[model samples]
Target: MRRYGPAVLLLLTGAAILRVALFTELYLRYVQAGLRPYLVGSGFLLVLLGVAAAAVGRREREPHGEHDGHHGPRIAWLLALPALALLLFPPPALGSYSAAREAEQRAAQGIGSFPALPAGDPQALTLAEFSSRAVYDSGRSLTGRTVRLTGFVTRDDDGTWYVTRLLVSCCAADATTSKVEIREADAPPADAWVTVTGIWHPKGRLGTDGAWPPVLDAASVRRVAQPANPYERR
Candidate 1:
């Protein structure tokens, strides 16, 4: 039990990571979608390594009446922490708290010309994509289009409103916000997911993705159920 305890913990950790990454929305809060395969492979590898280690431990069991590291039960409580955390208190997706940091990073990246939006009258656009055009394209593409933007609410101190989405590069730790300032309509409570349909506000004062996030002259605000994926890729 002791000698193979770490292997068991490795198995559990891998299982927890795999299950969360594969089966639950919780994975969206921590990692990018593209990383799922690696997580699954890692879990399987851990389980296999643990099994092999346990097999070797059993084969090397010392003769009777001997107290050694092999026979002694090794309990690695520390190894169980990650699994325990994921199993107990799952993580929530990044919200307004992280919006500020993400916005700053995006603004600093220096906006460049972006590709044209797909052919559609009210094209559904992610916050990151919209912000890129808003900042870099200089309103060349979005000037007259009625676009649909979906994200959660983030209110500024002066009663301003925004519909925002966090962009994940590698993981949540490296996540950044790409939001749109809401003009002409009141928004829902902070962090409440909603889809806004409106035209882009011809550029705006910029500070951060959170502070400015470009501008959207929202014509309608409809609160919708949160989508399965919150963080938009790239």
Candidate 2:
């Protein structure tokens, strides 16, 4: 058992990776969809290597073969525990805690114009797009338009709640917060997914600090299940 410790660890880790990357969509919780192929390949490679290592260990234990019967460090199994945990119970996607930790930061694009929204009664828009138009669009593209946005709930100490989503360039490690202050509606629960439909409530001058986090005068807020891909791709 001691001699096969490395092989067991590798197999457990590889199975965990395959469990998420090949068997389920759970991988999206930590990485962009584009990386799924790479993850699948890596997991397959690990499993192959693990099998090879186990075969070599078995050959070493054969009669007349040079072998050390001594046990390995007991603590070495600790390295494999995380892989087991992930295989059985993967961690949830990043949520309010991640959003709250992010400092308020927006690009210095200055005031700019936005294209007219497509004709629709209530346009579905991403939180990032809504925020950008609300904060920096000189054209005020969101004004008077009924828009629908979806995100998990997050709150401030002052009781102000937001519909927040994280935008990632590649993976959750690079995620950045994008949120909107939802007004006139009761917040569902912290980290609960919700769809907010409302008209833009403009505040402050365009392209200034005051316009950040753009407010929405919500007409209706509805609870919804979390999406498969929680993070928005940048």
Best by TM-score: 2
- Against the true structure, candidate 1 has what lDDT? 0.77
lDDT of 1 by residue, 18-129 (tens): 7777677667778877888888788788878878877886777555776664444444566677776765677778888788555355645554556677788799988887
Models 1 onward score TM values of: 0.79, 0.95
In model 2, which regions exceed 4 Å deviation? 62-71
Best by lDDT: 2
Residues 1-234, candidate 2: write the lDDT tens digits. 666788887888888889999999999999999999999998998899899989988877533564354656778878878888977899999999999999887876878899999999699999989999999899888879999999999999889999999999999999899999999998888999999999999999898888888999999999999999999877
